[model samples]
Target: MIKWILILLVVAAVASLLGYHTLAGAAATGARILIGIVLVIFLLVLFGLFAVT
Candidate 1:
């Protein structure tokens, strides 16, 4: 799950960057949102892991 979240976060970040910087359009909004969600999930996982350790 953590790995999945990390992968998603990386994908989202890249997608958002590409969509906005390269493509440029409303499509970028979706990518940005995905990036935010993935980042939140990634942070949650990190927090959970820290708590466990």
Candidate 2:
């Protein structure tokens, strides 16, 4: 689970960077926001797993 979270984080980071580098448009901003949300959710899950263990 932790590993999955790490993978997700990396993907999110890459997506965020790409979105930021892309032209400032609605699509880019939308993508960035979506990735940010996904990253946060994954981080929360990782923390939950740690706490349970």
State every prediction's TM-score relative to the real structure.
0.54, 0.55
CA lDDT of each candidate? 0.63, 0.63
For residue 8, what is the lDDT in candidate 1?
Answer: 52
- Candidate 1: residue pairs that collide: none
Model 2: per-residue Cα lDDT over 1-53, one tens digit each: 44544555565567667774343344445556667777899999999999999
Residue range with the least summed lDDT across 10 consecutive positions in model 2: 20-29
- Candidate 1 to native Cα RMSD, angstroms: 6.7
- Superposed by TM-score, candidate 1 places the C-alpha of residue 37 at a distance from the truth, in angstroms, of 0.3
Cα lDDT tens digits for candidate 1, 28-47: 45556666787898999999
